[model samples]
Target: MDNKAVEALTEAEAKAELAQLAGALAQANILYHGQDAPGISDSEYDALKQRNALIEARFPKLKRPDSPSEQVGAAPSEGFAKVTHVVRMLSLSNAFDGDDIIEFDERIRRYLGLGDVAPLEYTAEPKIDGLSLSLRYEAGKLIHAATRGDGAVGENVTTNARTIAERVAEGRKLPDIPLLIDGAPDVLEVRGEVYMSHADFADLNTRQVARSDKQFANPRNAAAGSLRQLDSAVTRRRPLRFFAYAWGELSAPLSDTQMGAIERLNDFGFQINPLTALCDGPAGMLAHYDKIEQLRAALGYDIDGVVYKVNDLSLQGRLGFRSTTPRWAIAHKFPAELAWTHLEAIEIQVGRTGALSPVARLQPVTVGGVVVSNATLHNQDYITGLDSKGQEIRGGKDIREGDWVQVYRAGDVIPKVANVDLSKRPEGSAVYVFPDKCPECGSPAIREDGDAVHRCTGGLICPAQAVEKLKHFVGRAAFDIEGLGAKQVEQFYLDGWVKEPSDIFTLGERFSSGLQQLKNREGWGEKSANKLFQAIEEKRNIPFARVLFSLGIRHVGEQASNLITRNYTSWPALITAMDAAAACEGVEWDNLLGIDGVGDVMARSLVMAFAPGPERDSIDKLTGHLNIEDAEHPDIDGSPVAGKIVVFTGTLEKMTRAEAKARAEALGAKVSGSVSAKTDLLVAGPGAGSKAKKAADLGIETIDEDGWLQLIDGL
Candidate 1:
C-alpha cells in the first residue's frame, strides 16, 4: 500500500549491503529455480528482498534502474555476430513433493517406452547461485560473455567479458576464477553459473562492516550483483568464479568422455565445477540429487539445487531442442521456492496486433528472491477461469481479486500465477471480464473463431492500433525504414506527421525543410538524417513478400507472405487473383493453395486486409513513399524443399537448421507440413517424434535430417 523505503546509507555502506544482498538472493534463487533445490526458506529470502527494495526506494538517487530491484539481470553480450541459442532453456513440469518427482519419472518412462529400463541416471550437483553466462570458445579461447537476458538475444557485454578474460588470463589477483578461453579457440558458446563462495561473500561483507560499510545479505547475490557491473574491472575485482553446466557453439571436438569433457574444459582454463560427475542412469542421478538435497544446509557456496545431464554426447545431439530448450536435458530441480500473495487487481494490455492480453497486479510478494508485482493473465478465457470449470479444471478453482495466490519462477525466468486461496477472497468481486470495445478507440472488439486471442476491430482509428501499425510499417521486419524506430514513430504521430502505414511515405514531403532540423537533436546529425532518407529510398521499391507482410495482414507472417508472393509471382497478379476468386469457394483457394502452407485461412486474411476497407486509404498513402513492388516468384518446379512438409528435429552434425532450411528452399521441392499424410517424407533424426509416428500412420517415409540433406545434395 505504501512505498517501503529505508533511511539513506553512505556510498560504502550501500555497496556493502548491496553486495551482500546480491550474493544471498542469488544463492537462494539459484537453488530454487535452477537446481530445484531449496537452501534458505522462502520467507527468509522475502525478508531480504523487502530490505533491499526499502533501501533502494529510500535512496532513489543511489538506486540504479539497472539495479537488481528493477532489472532482469544483464543481457548477454553480442560482439561477435550473434548466435541464437539453438536450444531454448525450458523447465520441466514440476512436482512440489516427492510424489511429483516419482510421477515425472513415470512420465519419462511412458513417453520413451522404457518399461523397467535401468533407473534414470541424473548428475546431481549443487545448483550454483549466480548470473548465468554463456561463453563461446573457438578452439578453446573465451570469445564472448553474455547475461541470460530473455533466453534469446542478450546485451553484448564483450567489454566486461574482455576484462574478466584479462584478469583470469593474467592470474594476478583472483587465481580461482573459472577460465574457458585458454588460448582462444574457435566459436564454442558454453553456459554456466558464476558464483562467489558463501565464506567469501561473508568475508567481503565483514570487511565492509569493519569499515562501517553495508553488508551483503548472501553469497548468491554477491556473485550476480558483482558480475553485472558495467565496468569489467569492477567485475574483475569481485571474487567471481564460474562453474560451467552446458554448451552452445563448439569448434574442434570436445573430449570423448563426459567427465573427460569437463576435465578438458578445465584444462582449457575453464573452471568446471568441482562437483559435476558421470552417473550411470536415472538411479545414479536421483541418488546424487538425494545426497545433494540431504546436504541442503551446508555447502561451500550457495547452491539452490543440482543439475543432471546425460553423459553421452551423441545421445545429446540426437535429443536436440524444443521451441526454447533442449530435449537431451532437463534441470531435475528440487522443490522450488514458493510464496503466497493477494491478487490486488487485473488490467488488460493491448498488444501491437490489437490482441487484448490480461495482466494481473498482485500484492507484491517475493518468490524465490525477486519481488514480483505483476503476472501475465494469459488470455480472456484464462482470466474468466473458464477452463477451471470445464475439462481442464483444477478442482474447480477460480481467481478473484484479493484472493491469496501462490507464485514461483521456473528455470529462473517466467514468473507464473500458481494456485489461489479462494477462502481469502474479498466481497463484491466478480469474474474479470474482457472488454468488448477497444480501450483506445472504443471500437467493438472481436474474437476470431480459430484463435484464443480477442482482438480490437478498430483498425485505423484506435490509437494503440495506429501507433503500433506505424511502428510496424517502418520496423526491421517490415519496411526497415532507418531512423524511424518506435520513438520516432511516436514523435511523428504526436506531431501529426504520421498515423497509418501510408503516412510514413508522406513524412519526406510533409517536413522536408524541418527534416533537416532533426539532425541537431540528441542522436541526430546530417550524416544520420541523410542515411535515414537514403534507407527510406532503398526500401521504396518493395519486395512483394515484404510488402505483403508489411500490410499487417492478420495471420500472414514473413514466411507465409513469402509463400503467397511466390505463388502469385507479383503483387498485381496476386491482387487480381484474389479479386477474381473473392467469392470463390474452397475450389478457388485450392488453385493458389498448392503453394506450400497456403490455405483458406491465409487466403481470407489477404483478401480481408487488401479488400477495400476504411484502412484502404492508408494503403494508398503508403504508395507515395513505398517503392513499386519488384518481386516475382522464382520458378518452383526445380526447388527441393517444395512439397515436403519438412519438420526439423534433433541435432544435425552439419550446419544449423536455419542454413539447412534456406538451402532446401533454394531447390524446388515444396516443403510440406509438420509430417502428415500429405508429407512425402518425415526427417527422422535421432529424436524423431509423434510427428514421425503420424507420418508412418499415413504411410509417409521417414528420413533423418541428414538424409533429407543428402536427397537434395548437389541439386
Candidate 2:
C-alpha cells in the first residue's frame, strides 16, 4: 500500500486492517514458534508488524485487544516443560528504513535528556533468524538451556542442547576458556540464538530428501525442530550452531558496557556475531546495517535483520522498556523475496468434515530459502478476489490456470499467491471454475449460507469423506491405534477387512479364521500382523470421550465430545440421551443445548447423528465390541464449584466467556449456557438481563464474573 493511501485510511478501514494484521501475525507466530515452520519471511512479518504499529499509532483508541504490538512469539507447544525466565526476554522494536533508525535514536536521546551533546554509542549486530535460547551456567558449568517461548517463559531443552555438542567437545574447540571458567560467577544465564548454517541446512535438507522425509522449510525451522526434539539423538544428528548475543540473570556483572560484555562472553568460549561493532550514532548504525544487508546473501546462517542496542548498560537501564519491547534496541529488517511461478492447476481435497480445500499446483520455484510447488488457495473466494466479508481485494482480480503469479511465503508454512502478473497471462485463458461435485464420489458439494467452504453433503457414503473420517478416528487425539494409519486403513478397506469402527476390534478373529491369511500379504509377516492385532485389541477398552470423537460426527470436536461424555458419564447414558433427544424436541434436547458453547447447530448435528439410522447402528456396533470407560472429572476437593452446573451470561469484563467456562470446567464444574433448575451458579456479567432475571426468579445463586473468579481463586 502507498503511504498516502495509508495516511488517508478511515477509522473503519484502520480497524479492519488491524484485525487482519492481528490474525496474520498470530498465525505466523504459531507457524514459526510452535510448528518450527515459518510460512512468511521475516521481512514480511516485520512489515506486517510495522503496518500494525502505524495503524495503532494513527487511531490509538481503535487498537484491537489481540494486537501484535502486545504479543511476543507463540505459546510453547505442550511437548516440552515450560521454564519461566527470571528476567523477561523481551523482543525488540522494528525499523523498516533508515529514517526509522534516525527516529529511534532521536527518541532515545530525548528520553535520556542527552540533548545530542554527548555522543550516545550503540552496538550493531546481525539479528540471527533462528530459535532463541537461554543457557544457565552455575559455577561456570553449563546446566540448562531453554527456548524463548513467550518472552516470559520458555521450553527446557537442556538435553537437546547437550546433543548439539558435549561440554568436552565444545571446550576443546576454544583453548581460551575451559568448561569451567576461572573466577566466573556461581550463576550465569547467557542468552543467545541457536541456528543452522546455510551449508549445514542444505546438507540436512539433502539427507531429509534422501531419506524421503519432509524437508524443512528453512534453516531457522530446521534449527528449532532439531533443538526442541524430545529425543536427543535426533538433535545430535542435526548440525546446529549457536551465537551468544545477550545475557539474562547473572550472579555478577561481566562488564560495564555492552561491547565489553560481548567480549567477555567471547572469552567464555561462546560464539558471538562476527559483525558485532560499536556504532557512534544513527549514521554509524545505518552504515553498518547497509553493510550487513549487502553481505546477507553470503552469510553462513540466516540473519533476518541487524539489531542496534544502546552500548552503555546504565543508559539502557535508564531507557527502560515499552510494554512489549525495549527502548534501548531496534531490529532493522531486510526485504522479502517474491518469484513468479506458473499456476499449473488447482486441486480440491475433501477433509473429514467434508470441507473442500483448494490447493494450487504451481511450477516449482524457490521463494526465500524453500522450494514451493503447492500453495493453499484457502477457499473459492480467495481465488475469485473476494475476501471472507465479500470485500473486493486485488482490484477484484481472479487467479487463472496457466497464468504467471507472484508466490511468496511469509512466516506461513504454505506458500501463497501474492499477486497475479496479468501481463504474462496465457493466451485465451479462462477463469478457473470450482467443482460443484466431489471428485471421489460424485456427491453434490454444496456451500452452506454464510460459510466460505463448499462441503460434500454425501456424509459417510462418500469414499473421500469415509477415508478421511477413518484417518481421524485412529488419529493421535482419537484411538491412536498402532500400525493403523491412513495408508493401512485404505488398504484394509480395499481388502474388505475393515468396513466400520467395529471391524477394527474383530480383525484378529477375521484373520485367524478366514481363508485370506494376514501373513500372506507382501508386506505382512506373522509377528507384524500379530503386533497390529495386539495393538487393536489393547485399544478395545477406550475412554468414552475418545469413543465419541472417533465416530467422526460433524460439529462434535474433541472438547465438545469431552463435555458431552463428562455430562453423561457413560456411553450408554449418552446414547440414551441422544436417542431421546433425536426422537423429539423436549427437555433432553434443551439439556443438550444448555451445555456452554454447544448451540443449536452443534446440538442438532449431534442429535441427527444419533437418530435411528446407519450412523447410530455403526456406533452401536462399535460400542458392543469395546469396554468404554466412564468420563472422569478431576476432584476439586473442598471447592464450592466442584461438580456443579454453572451458567455464564453477557459480556465478561475480567475474562472472555470462553476463558470463564474453561476455568469453571477445570474446577470440576459443568458450565452450561442457559439458567436452569439444574444450574447451581449463575455468572452474570454486565448487560446480562434475561438470564440474570431468570436465574434470580429460579432462586439460583447469582454472581458476577469477579465473584466467580473469587470463588475459584484457590482451587
TM-score winner: 2
TM-score of candidate 2 relative to the true fold: 0.65
Give the per-residue lDDT digits (tens) of candidate 1, residues 107-153: 54443445666555544456676767776655554556766654654
The CA lDDT of each predicted structure is 0.58, 0.79
How many clashes in candidate 2? 10
Q: After superposition, how far is residue 415 of candidate 1 from its true place, in Å?
A: 4.6
The residue-by-residue lDDT of candidate 2 on 1-715, one tens digit each, is 2455567766656655565565557556777787776655666667667878987787765554347887778666556787889988888888888889999998887666667768899999999988888988898787788888878778899888876545223334652213456566788888888888888889999999999999987888899899999998898898888888899999988888999999888888877888999999999999999899899889877888899999999878656665568879999877677788899998988876677878789998767775667766767888999755567677888988898888775544455677888889888999889999988788999976656778898877887777777877886558978778767888878778877778888876666653247678777777877778889889989999999888877656665787788788898898889888988959898888777657565678789888888888888888888999998876888778887898888888766564566567657798776887778988888899899998888899998888987887766
Relative to the true structure, candidate 1 has a C-alpha RMSD (angstroms) of 12.9
Please estimate how well model 1 matches the true structure, expressed as its whole-model Cα lDDT.
0.58
Q: Which runs of model 2 end up more than 4 angstroms from their true locations? A: 1-162, 165-194, 199-217, 221-237, 242-337, 389-391, 513-523, 648-666, 683-688, 703-715
